[model samples]
Target: MKLAENMLFKYGSGKVIRVLYINPFTSIIYVIDMDSNRWSYPIPKDDFLTAYQNKEMIEENDDIYCRAVPEEELNELEKQKRDQAWEIVTFFKSKLSDDEHMFISKYRQKAMKETMAVFSISYNGLKNILIKYFKGSQTKCSLIPSYFRSGARGKERKAGNKKRGRPRKNGENAGVNIDENIKKVFKIGLNRYYYNTRKNSLKTTYELILKDFFVKEVIDENGVKIPVLNNVKDLPTYEQFLYWFRKSLNDGKREIIKREGTRVYQQNYRAIIGSSTQDAELGPGTLFQIDSTIFDCHLVSSFNRDIIVSRPILFLIMDVYSRLIVGFNITFESLNSYSGAMVALANSMTSKKELCKKYGIEIEDNEFPFCVPNRILSDRGELVNGYINGSIQNLGIIIQQTPAYHADYKGIIEQAFNQTNIKILPFVDGAVIGGNSKRERGEGLDYRLKSSMTIEDFTKVIIKSILFHNNHHVLSDYILEESMIENNVEKIPIRLWEHGLKYKKGQLRILPEEVIKTSLLPSQSGLITPKGLSFKKMLYASKYALENNWFQMARIKGNWKVKVCYNPTDLTDVLVFDEHGDGPFKFSLLEHLSMYSGKGESEIEQIKNFERELERTGKERELQEKMKLFTEIEDIVKEAREKTEAEKNYSKSNSRRLKGIKENQKNERLLHREKAKKEREMEVILDESIEEEDEFAMFRDWEESNDDE
Candidate 1:
């Protein structure tokens, strides 16, 4: 290799040197030892070339040997040091001429001392700066202070009997050395007092340590227990306590979780690495976030306007890339169950035309596009179920469940809920405002009583809100791609979605509506009984089952179980998949159970419970009535037996008593018929007599009035 200035070479013994100056006229080279930052003796050019050729010396890249620090990473002190060094080096170089430069390269003590005095820098400092400048290719960054290496990071120092750190001032006693025993005490105190939800400050924890570990209780002469502190000189100081506390609990996450509650820390204190859309999503439909929140307003029942239905749970599915709310479901179903999540997911993958039409809202196809996402992110709620995971996976969709207590993982949907509420809730009647404390203090009218909108009406309003959000609402903080900017696309959800479809396509997968419904609908095992398909204690029938005589076969061969999928929000029909690959078919409720036709799962359960309670009460009343009738029969039997016992010695033989039994029975029946006819005649005569008396009295009063006139 050709020798040049600032070139590095490593000797056979592994000592590295940088070429400071090369003199072709004298056939000599000047270099400096990089490790010691000192000048080395001059070497003959021929000898150096021989060593390099013989493999006794190897050429090294200066970049590997020289340290370069970024200016931004430098602290104030480091920057000042670097500037000072650069100024000194610049002044020294300005003073040197071409002749003096070569002379100084040979480590001339007289010239170096004179220059150092002029520059107000020590001789060694000047020499070190010169070595660094040449070795680092004369870059200003090479002079940055390496204070990071000053304290010997990662190197443990053994503590001596003397205190290791700075001593106290104000004539205070010097603190004792912290040994293994003292470290143990510090750990115990920290664990007991500091790392807990109590949130004790460092000083409070140190005081607690002093009180508990460094003080002893003594009985005074007055028979009172008094606390006595240990010698101040022998006790560990507060600084040592804090230092060891941080060192012992070095993991930030663990410390946060211990200091605060896990839930609080995760919700408030945990570091957010990056947004899901920017960090993980590629384009629209690549990733979707699904979450559910309780709606802020109460709603009236659609059937009974007087009844107030509690707040409905709003399930939203938003595209992570475009922040477009692809689908949503508003229902009374709770967020804990997978029912609402499944419905929301199914809605997300299917067309929203019917949904919008049902709510009487019109929208274009492009306004709310429905497409299956490659991955769906959700909290550890509904979508975290094993069955849901399997079902979604079968559709070639990946399920990403967020860590426990980490709701921010699906923050896109969470934010959408908040935004939707903020836009519409203010105008809605019965909207929940402020915290529960306000309600407890009776600040306003009862929200439940003020509710006026039904679920359907509220759903329509939400659809309108969503439409506005998708098409017209501007996303001020939305990040745009270079292509979007070039095309002058507006920062709106619909525009972003349209652009994504045109440019970044293929992330969206479209399946048939029926397929998506069957896959995402919540499923449960139903029994095929003689009555019908028994599910949730409700009987259902299908045309296929009727034609195949499934019920008839079940009647003969006992009931069997099969997996069935159903929409919990509407239990009128369920889906049963055929094992022989005929596809899933709908099972409608049996005609005999028409009362439960439009009822949901929870409503049906409640109705069944009410009916059961009624049956139990009716059975109890029937038992009481039957007991009273039996008591009357017993009384009649006793009266007849008493009359027989009172009769004097008059006994009829069994044959005599039985003789003419048929004739006697006929006579008795005729007499009873005659008696009933006479009683009916008397009742009719009495009613006629009462009517005639009233008529005669009216006539008499009219005649008297006429005579008086």
Candidate 2:
């Protein structure tokens, strides 16, 4: 590929504004700022090509070729430059206004003079230096009095002047320009034929790259020359090897590398920079991030703190822009989409007043907003996918899901969780995060000995952490020129939110309370039986459902399939949607023999087992056997929740493991109570029949004695 001056190419940030310089060699290109100004330091051809994405083009030598600079980007860059120029003319010009001080034009001349003198070049170099001085961030340094940029440039220019012409290193001068080599070799290792997942580290690949050049020619028996490894001292230094090895790793960005396909990088490595919610569609109520993180602490059952339950999962929704926690749930329950999706969905729409109250955190009015975000960024959990996604979309809120296993996409909330770990969890009595240091410096710290924190206690800490993040955490704009905040405004998250809400109101949305509340509840399809509704292997018939003739009128399909919404937190009542006059009416259900909230889905399975057992035995025998079965179930769950979390059983998946342990424990106290009630009824009926027989026998005996006499 032939290269020339005035041709545009991509540099570091996919920007084509950095035009090729007036002075360029076959292997090098000079950096240029907007307005076609160039730098003394020449970028190597390989480095220029590294950043190419093939989407941009530049006109050179009457041929249209792909350039780092795209035609469309040129227009945008110029517009941006024009805006910056206006800002400089308005705000920056005032700083130079005293009559005694040099005029702005004079300062520009001085800055340009310093640049040309430092590069050891002529008037040709003067234009490039002057252009960069006014256009780049260096302008800010220039505006500061007593900040002589010339003094700093003298050292750098001397270094560049001395190294101006050495044997052209592939995109770098004689210094270890090993980046190109390492990237090339590392990519080769990424191929399935060369890359071995079972054994390959960056260090291994680094050594391999050095080995490629660490060869000496040797005479073979046939008098033909063969390349063989030289002495150990002849090998490339490890420092250079490691430096280039690390350069090959461009976190989540492998625009120039081809090795990602050899191994599934997506599952093993999280890209540091990719599809983030932090900067995307940010506003007061436009982007909300939802994620489930297990708190870095061990918690016990609220009923008993001495017994270790498990580290609870924190299902939270954070407003991406405001850093305000909208809604969350803390439980020792495993990752149920019901807890994850609904809690976040409800949190986005409803007031945090009730949520704060539940956790005993007090809040003033408007401390947090109750408006729903127009778009939510969530992981591909069961809730934001499949059927639940369609259900939530009905409320007119768009759901944007993060690609599988990409935690960076939801970094805004992940950062919030990190704050909770660093600040709040440490003070809590039983946090495991203390042991996260290298070499397990906190190995012997038995947090469980101090495991006095309950799920509710941890919940309070989370609320405080959120309040601290929103009300006190300082936020800064990445690009100050385009910040939503004015120079005079505070940068706290809550303050930013207030400002953005008042000014940057981009598609802010809020659903009606009923609509949002219903949206938050999990929906399931159920068949309306004559006995009421059959769902999850249990028969549930509400007073409203039975009274409305849901079963009789449901003969359209032989049985009507009704949409059922139930609070996972409370299974005592389910809302069976009766679409009559006033939306879906609430329904009070007759309690099933077993399936309750505490049992979770285990109750459904237990009920099925109980039914099967009853079929094997008669009703009376079944009742007696269930009394024993229920007692055993309670014992099992009681034992699990009460088990102390010792070091031996501690795991990262503590919440899930404990849930499995508890599942084995099976809480069938409801089953036991029902069985006892039926037993008592049977005893009364048996006693009354016996008494009636005794009375009839006594009357017959008395009549026979009287006749004989």
Candidate 3:
């Protein structure tokens, strides 16, 4: 039979088949014999047609060319051939064209055998196969998907026309091709074929025919199969496909393929917030607290007996809940008494802004507000309580000293202090004792007091250092606290509670006041006392308590001695009556007065001022009553004088009424009338009044004489 001639298809001699025959008819391919005798034995029609049809098919409108190599260079040439084969196979699996895909799948298998013969078999082929099955037409290079789906189309065809937003095209059929039969049938157009078969041909063919073919599996150096043998068939039959998928997900071959895109080894980590089981026993501010010891690095000051150089102590209170440090203090001397504890409490209670300013740190206020710890847990060191048992009592915070020699109880802050002293500070040269001390000495012995490189500088160092340590140090393998917050991604502790709020839901949780109270009281824990509970021979207490019981505590000397208070309920209103209840033996005014009297006599002056006002008001009342009585008597006397003058009708009285008659009218008749009337009134009234001695009597008598006639 005469065949059509086409230059594009002609290789060495014979003319190729008709253009229409160049379809996915792979059944026609064969390795032909060169001898003329083969012409008598007619070429197998299927094989001949398969070879002619697939060869004639051109993809991307490109011509096929073979690279020629010398016989001696076959090994190297074979390697290049296998690599080219892998590329072609990958491209083939990506749904480029039906005829081209079939051609590549055939040659890729051939390349695999050749590669095994001449070089190490590359697993890239197997990777390409798996990617084809799973990744599918999800990539842009998948020609079938590119032809069917437009970039301007919405994610789905049924959706309404998209507005200004960019459109999405699905890549579901990326690495799969149209089935040979489906392609042949579709050559007639979309009119007559079954829609389901047309849509799913590529996927179906990939799963059945091409799935295992291109995945060239072989043995490795360890003699283990390349694609690990997981009996996917043996997985739970209930959800076999899903089980197989998961098994395939963990398959060795998939892992090998995945490894190619990344480095050979990498660390995988996740940091999440978690609570300690021990936290259940501890209250909000209960349990062991820790801090660093700032020794008097100056050997001279430390060695000297007379001139004392105080070693600053860092006191950290750990809130067992979130394993967070709730309160802390930096001081030259330790907390050994109530006063020091109070100062530490005051420092802790100060505003976060003040802490930030003193320490030179930036903190976010929203997340990490300054924390007020309910209790302080620390080592059995006097410094922790500021060397005064009563120091921290007034602040209403409980003081708990861990057992002697048990460092693990305070491990949280202890580890922090160790890191501060050993790791972080060591990076700084002056952080060492000698170095810091000399520098500090250059400033002065009282460096912290001057606010100028003296006391202020020392104070600043501590404040800044604590800030730096708490907010900047790494706490665990994954978590770090900048200030009061934990940060995992930035890998630094947030200096303020605000930054820590991201982890708030995890770490800082709120508990009711009753829970805290219940945990603190005797029926619950019975931990506190007026003299304070005796533990390891030390006394601790809540400040307002006075009863000496298992819970009541007192500050004696420098130690916190727990004097068991008989009553726990009488914390704020403990009444200390003397031997007799009569008069209540009140420790009121004098006792209250004596405490602050030495500081300044201001209280005494206030009392004196109050008493003077009281005396002045009393005298004024007496004078007011006397003045009223005198005024009433004057009114009665004036009435009587008028009555006598009217009844007498005397010529002298009429003459006296004239103006300027006072000197001329010294009438004896008027005087006799006035005397007789006065006598008659005195007899009627019988008025025996007490003798009146008035300093104004002379002035009154002179005015009276001048007015008289």
The best candidate in terms of TM-score: 1
lDDT of 1 by residue, 144-254 (tens): 565634443224457786677787789777678777888888778778888888988889988998999888899999999998999788887777776766655345666
lDDT of 1: 0.74
Candidate 3 lDDT over residue span 442-532, tens digit each: 5544432211122234445555555555456554643433533323244343432333333322122222222222222122112232344
Clashes of 3: 75
Kindly report the root-mean-square deviation of model 3 from the true structure over all alpha carbons: 37.6
Q: Please give each candidate's TM-score.
A: 0.54, 0.41, 0.26
Candidate models: Cα lDDT each: 0.74, 0.54, 0.36
Candidate 2 local lDDT, 151-236, one digit each (tens): 33112122322333245445432333333444465555444222443345556665665556567788999999887876654344
Inter-residue clash pairs, candidate 2 = 9-68, 10-68, 44-171, 57-67, 636-665, 637-665
Between prediction 1 and prediction 3, which has the larger lDDT? 1
**Which runs of model 3 end up more than 4 angstroms from their true locations?**
1-277, 280-292, 299-310, 318-326, 334-337, 358-368, 382-400, 423-453, 477-492, 495-709
Runs in model 2 lying further than 4 Å from the true structure:
1-274, 277-282, 304-306, 336-339, 362-365, 380-384, 434-445, 476-487, 525-562, 570-573, 579-582, 587-709
At residue 610, candidate 1 shows an lDDT of 65
- When 2 and 3 are scored with lDDT, the better candidate is 2
Ordered list by lDDT, greatest first: 1, 2, 3
Candidate 1 lDDT trough over 10 residues, lowest sum: 65-74
